[model samples]
Target: MKTATGCTVISNGTAVIGTGAAPIKDATIVIRDGKIAYAGPVAQAPEVEPDATVIDARGGTILPGLIEAHFHPTYFNVEALEDLDIKYPVEYVTLLAASNAKLALECGYTSARSGGSLFNIDVWLKKALECDLVPGPRLAASGREICGVGGLMDWNPDYRKIGMDGLVLLVNGPDEARAAVRKLVKDGVEWVKTYPTGDAASPDVNDHHTLCMTFEEMHAVVATAHNHGLKVTGHCRATEGIKNALRAGYDTLEHGTFVDDEALEMILERNTPVVPALYFELASIERGPEFGLSQRVIDGHQETLEGGAESARRILRAGGRLGMGGDYGFGWNPHGQYARELSFFVNYVGLTPLEVLTCATKTGAEILGREHELGTLEAGKLADVLIVDGDVIGNISLLEDRKRFIAVMQGGIIKAGELFRSQA
Candidate 1:
């Protein structure tokens, strides 16, 4: 794949299926012009480009590159949200975001959807990755999240003259919400992320259960973004927030920890995808001390964790799509450990290993609206592939190591690992 030519082929592997009907044994995948030409048994392999580069998986598992449905590339390696909002300079955060992107790619994630970012960093980074100016995943960029004043993202001290300007778009009403979303579209965002509720980490009246936006403001955001050809997702953990987002035509939900019967019904009826982001809550409880969180805050996180798990199960049982990813760049959950979400699904959410893989790949792509080109290994799909050296089905934890990958290829280009020889 380093030969400058985009033609490549990968052979001699067992393909783990992702929305491709079923798995294949002794498979051969061919990539021509950065797109899949064949993906099936080696016996029926087709001819490839005369000088095409070929990679031997050595009887490994060939799977679709994992997708991160909610990623914060601009947060960097911050110890807390305050670091991201106050201490870290915009220039440093932007540079650190580039490193995180490369790290995520090295971890075998070929695609990422930006949940939100500081200013328009995600916008510029997405363009850079697309144009080959940087090495990263195919990013669906969402710029600074729109939040109501004093909401979850409005973390600045009101009495202080200085404010956290780079982190959020502080909108006060319906008109401001509409303008915020329109400005995001104009700034080159593909998705609009909003704060429809507060955080459980907060202790005041603005707790996780507090509604951040009125119905009118939420409705205006959805309408404006949809009109400008963008999908709207929200940070909605409150039950009322979920209901409000649903009624306002929000396309997706993030961290739906407090969803109830009605919200579950609404989600299924609309077929809205949700990335439960279960790990962050657990991380807070387990590693909260290291981050200076109080005992009360840690206790609150335990409740949030239980509620998120139950909500996730209910959504899955109802046959609603559930994608993986959440707050991975924070101090507790660093980058390159994205595969942990898969384990959380199996051990906590009660999903099987196969089910977790399918959700992370196929359903994640569906959430990002790239179901055709990504999420599966088949003819005509982009060559976004991960060659794993171990039996992924038996021990999903092996994915936590970047070295476990024999090669990570996206669009016929090798991003990590090495594939030296081929027989085509």
Candidate 2:
């Protein structure tokens, strides 16, 4: 339930302050009317009214609620795109999408940005969550992916040419590209997704070398999106595709698994955000056989898994903007395991535990363009807090356990981790 006005004093916790990567011992955070009123050392804490609700974190780490910078709420958790379309009706898929939204919040994610969605369901889902018809993270929706005809999402038999409606918007030229972006804007999306390159799962094109849409077409889409006050991102895996997308001014690159030195230089120069969702690729490798995927498809994933890690390492080492978000909601990866991406970043991508947490917290907010209000725990910011019952700084994997998340407060509302339900 949303509190109209409530004060919460969280004492006896180690507060992980925002952006600076420091912790306050014996911190006391006072939340008044759903905003962080005070967050500092216990000695400097402001005196609170006796009636205010108090939550003791038991000396656990209190960090900002994680933001899933790349999300697809309508996807079938663990199912491939083709299987999602073939195995389930749209009605079932819609219900599952709503379920995924809630799971995201339960996992301590307070916000999510839609990477893409089935139909315009993400736009409606965002609204539903806003109206409290459903429980979910704050979403920035991208209605449907804009793709060239015969692009990555052109998943259909050649002879039948079955309409893949509600998933991909097929465009051919610059005119069609511009039209598609305008239509997505009209459909109430904050971002427009495009398939700049074919993915590893595609049956029609090479995963690493093939370009899906022309440079001119992407330029048109980016221009239209920017003009309409929408961010534009692309599913780019090919080195050439990355170059084209950056040149055309796409704001973010999803699955930038094949970034060459030249592409990396351009991304650094433009300060573009890259979300290399490597967990999904790893999941594909582990569960492809169970999903009835061809060995060829399973074999192809290894390259992406290895290449994506190296690409991320390079980007991180070069001090480029890299964020965390699993391409969850597929059959194997699932929705609530977005934290696995953080572990992948630490172990495989060669980042420290603290670095991974920073990416998940601060860099994720930067990716969503909500760094001002979200991300770090600080005074005057929205109280999106995740209190984990462990030395989370020593082992980031503890965050993967929802039970360890003793309290999750989004705008001072306890959506999950009801640590003080009896007391309240």
Candidate 3:
């Protein structure tokens, strides 16, 4: 909550820069009033203030603080579809959301864009974070996910007489979709999240390849959201759904799992950012059985994992923007483990460590539309930087280990890691 007023100097580290260039050895980063003034080789760094606070990186890797592009601050320990909304009342879920926000900040995520939240909780969560009432990432809230009546999120049976209103807004047609986007605009959401297709979670009903919202409804959502100066993203899995989203002008695509050649070409042509969110599928396949998930569900997740990884590889190879972060509040993939997505991409999706880092930092900010302000270590950007205990390029998994975090800075203020603890 504190605004950093004095100048600060971070030196003696290899800077990754988050610009896809080669890492700079013996780099120095200068901060002034919570903005980066310089970031480059020490030999070319400008002279610092005489009484500036100095932080030694200790031969660690300096890079931009990570951005969780497909966050869900409202979901916690979700084991089943019902667990997302029915397991906890809205009041309790709000508290849990606050806790998850703090955990994201401590885990080195300086910014996040909520993929979806319950009861528009992320809107209020963003306000609280701004007021310093709770610690959290810089959030772009999507109040609630927009889905069709029998979509992937509407898993509760009609006989149960329960509504999915807590987590999703179920619309019947294009008019209803437009109305829903208006409601989100009134609720102060920065992005509109919609479901263009079902998910692997609902195997029998609306599986991964099944379309949920029609193309007309999807078009209505994008048109309405864009009119209000808000971007739109979709939970797109099927090939047709991906094309529909692209045709409807969706700003981003989540879990674009079954993208085929046509969808891939469309995604590249539109320059749309895609979040594979493959880690969630990995977790479901590897650990779902322990949580009583049925064999069918596990197999569905396996299929989703393979399809998503392949699509992600193709997108990256075609030079499309691939963002990181998604579905981190499940029982298998809990909060505070957001960095696992980075490692998953590097290890399983065949991305180099540096490529994955750029995806998490630079492309992530671009997806959020804050690239000029939040991403990279370049001058004239927010001073959100991470100092890892070792060469993160050499050991990409080092970022997943909290013990290796020497400092996590947001707006030039030390928020977590060794430096914050020492100050405390």
Candidate 4:
């Protein structure tokens, strides 16, 4: 055998049917220098080098590592709102992010895109992982969300006194929006998030189609971000807001609840992917009362739950690109339960098991503009993979438990492992 350093092989596994259209049974995945070198049936796999290490998969099912396209690390504590005051504290928030990161990794999410966060903590967490100071998924973060004055959440005036300027940008007009985008880029933001439409609790004072930002203002944010080599994502729930965001060149639309037929057509025409964070709606309905939410909030959530599913169905029927993302950190939604999003996608959004898996893996990497580096199990791609104890395709819900995973590896390093049995 040829000699090589830094090599490992996962043998005798059932490779989960991938985007390539077929499953490779009795498979072996060879890794070299943190990249996949070969992935196929063991009988077809080329001979490995003499010094390579081998991991026996014990007939487990292997698949490309999962990716969560929209998550919030800092606000993860919203899962248990009885502890609200303490959950938002900076120290507590940091610990919560750390805990969520570890949970996500262990749960087979090798990479994630943090949609929005407070205090720009996602940036710090990303840096920490890169430096090996912490263990977590590979992260792409929007430092903080930029919203219109009194847009989504009210900003506290005390933020100025505490020097927490990087938390959120509350801009009022076109000029302010441009400046805010510039400031976020200067602060090392990977992407810029904007709240284009108001929520149920805070509807836009203008027409539903007319959002907080004028067309010019929205254009400025998108232009500034694109000029700086960054992408822009918008929170849009209304049909009017969805069209405006598409016209403004936003990369992705989040939580599109009231999307009409025409807007769904536009999304298909434009080829912009929509992240239907249905888990947020489901969790809100099931867990809102525990958090002391008023009846009105609970009722409003029910309406959204019903409406969002219909919109998702329409989007899928129209052949629009759809991705899976759990809006974790609100109501009972928590990090590391990403697979549940797939179940909702399959049952509620009408996606097949293969399609849902692609949304979480291949489509997710494409949304982040990292398809070549992540997404599929291919030669030269990062070695992010998961091996489950049973055939996950038949029952996707089995993925909800980390214990079902026989091995979790990221960058060719095994993060978790099951104890070995003697070869008697």
Candidate 5:
């Protein structure tokens, strides 16, 4: 593609660790029309046109924009509330979602996937970001979670009613499950989310057992979603529910808290990616009381934290694909702390600094099926890049410091940085 007007060039920076091992120093990246035209050693760069913008890197490290494969945008502003009993209006929730989107971008995430949320708010947010009506990352969203009748949320008085904010769609049998998948598709959802298990934290519910849909029901959901070109993500922490979701062919498992040896092996065999929302668990424990969450939920959260590290270690040892995502919005976990999850993955799961970064960037893109479009810093890719002040390869903690981000560019636009002010 021809270089568009107001093209930008980032030069004299150390291209940080990409998906592959090793870093390229003294690299030059050419951004033409909001896409990377070239990325390599400075010596090999093409001659820059007089009108194109050139930015000095000051020896900083440049890397591809980070990707968070799982999160909840609706819960971004939970801190504003004082009590758990305060039921937020749907409009307020949508605004919170928009704020989270912007916060994610500010935190250096160029793209993210909302695991589940209400009213398809992410869909609208994605559009807003594309149109530049709002500042945010590109979002792939699951409209609403499909659950069994009287599933995680109790609605015994009227079983037909789904959860508030149009967030949950209740389906009873195989046929209903299939229809639910189609309904989300028609609603323009890019991914489908379902609960194969109930919420363990609720005091009223049984935490150990599986809250299952029939085998046929799960099968129909998977098949229907696949046929419609959407990936199915299942919420199942209990062993039985996790196994059932796997057998049903879910593309990814969210919050796999109780996966056993057999289930882990099967996950490895199937090459299914697991997103352990460890940060969310920790945050929940910290903020549960404020949410009026029963002691059972709080206790269950503590148990998840205690065991989550071991589970992550086992999954890594088994060679299963892993991605980083803080299920934002459940409680205290907010939108901007995407890097916090990496600390848990590194300290608890024993991932090296580079490995953890790779999981968050390259591996995360693969899970979202946007490897070609989003991950890595290479020729012919979107110019989603971040420049940090310190050497990220030597110390991963540098990534957590917001001040370290000297420049944030997404699609060649200088979203942050004084260097591009003259160009603008």
Candidate 6:
């Protein structure tokens, strides 16, 4: 239900404002015209009109809606990589993408940025969400990823005559790189995804340490993306690849696993956001055998798990931005289990719950360039709020329980949660 123009108040909650501020006890949130008119202690809450719709939070935790910094809407039940592009036709994949978007919103994510998608599905998905044809998160869409021939994403054999074109645009040189960025711009993408390094999943040919795209190609991609008013992020893991991306003025790094001191210095200097995406490694290590992955692949995932966690810790200690989101939509780590990434960071990565929450909310928004309006529960910001039935600060895993989500408000409307049915 749309919030009335007069007011809608959320009362009797403990506010865990996403600005890293301490939780405010007995907090109240006032919504007016789809914006936060006030959010503070209940005693200080402004007077509301008599007809205002007041939803009682019942002493729950109220925080900003979570943001998924690296989302892949087209990757569902992906046991093998071919499931990403080849197994399902584009028509079925589009429907799957729409389902994943709604799943993300129901899981408490109100905003997301596409890490990559098949057939530029996320571009049209964003429009569908805007028109309310779909119930989903606000999205910053990146079409197909840009990959060098024989890179991590280029798994299909050329002789098969079935290319990787559905998921990635394979480019050979700097000119092709620029042309690929132009294609993404024409497709109406807000961000450009690139593969600068290979993955541990492809250990034999292009392992984690190998660079996929040349420095010149990387630079051309960044330059062209920036020129066309789009930001570029890369699946960077190797030290050299990370350095190349940073030197090329890339906007963000995904799975920045092997950051040496030199790369750390560069990252801190540039103030770039690094999404460790460590949860995917953990899932791979634990469940690879079930999916017919070889022992070598499992070992590679174990190594990546350790290295990515350590890099994330170092980045956090050095005051760098460490956002949260991982490669979900696989068989083990499915789309609705998005909050597991936050739990993994707190339990395994040695970060406090509050720290992980900040990464998922505040830093995640900063990475999307929407921090000013959507990251925090402050006055004058968009009324994107999540009211949990428990103290999420004390038990961060409470966010994983959708039943505990009393209300999930996006733009002051009750989009999902236990209270949504009554409100609608």
What are the per-residue Cα lDDT tens digits for candidate 5 across 112-134?
A: 88887777787777778778888
Sorting all predicted structures by TM-score, with the top scorer first, yields 3, 6, 2, 1, 4, 5
Give the per-residue lDDT of model 6 (tens digit) for 1-424: 2343668999998998888888999999999999999999989888999989998988889999999999999998788896676788888999999999988998999999999999989999999998889999999999899999889988888875655458899989999999999989999999999999998889998999989999999999999999889999999999899999999999999989999999999999999999998999998888888888889988988888999999999999999999999899889778898899998998999999888989999999999999888889988888989999998888889988999999888989889999986766
Question: What local lDDT score does residue 14 receive in model 2, on the 0 to 100 scale?
Answer: 86
What overall lDDT goes with each candidate model?
0.85, 0.84, 0.92, 0.76, 0.76, 0.91
Error of 1 at 378 (Å): 1.4
| Deviation of model 2 at 386, angstroms | 0.7
Model 3 scores what on Cα lDDT?
0.92
* Each candidate structure's count of clashing pairs: 0, 9, 0, 0, 0, 0
Once fitted onto the true fold, the runs of candidate 4 whose alpha carbons sit more than 4 angstroms away are 1-5, 79-89, 155-166, 200-210, 417-424
Roughly what TM-score does model 1 have, to 2 decimal places?
0.94
Q: Candidate 2, residues 243-285: lDDT per residue as tens digits?
A: 9999999999998889999999998999998999898888889
Q: What is the Å distance of residue 65 in model 1 from its true position?
A: 1.0
Off by over 4 Å in 5: 1-7, 79-86, 153-165, 206-209, 286-295, 417-424
Q: Write the per-residue lDDT of candidate 1 for residues 49-147, one digit (tens) a residue.
A: 688777788877899999999999998757767677777678888898899999889888999999999868999999889888888888999988888
Model 6, residue 105: C-alpha shift (Å): 0.5
lDDT of 6: 0.91
CA lDDT, candidate 3, residue 373: 89
The TM-score between candidate 3 and the true structure equals 0.98
List candidate 6 segments past 4 Å from native: 1-4, 160-164
Give the least accurate 10-residue stretch of model 3, judged by summed lDDT. Answer: 156-165
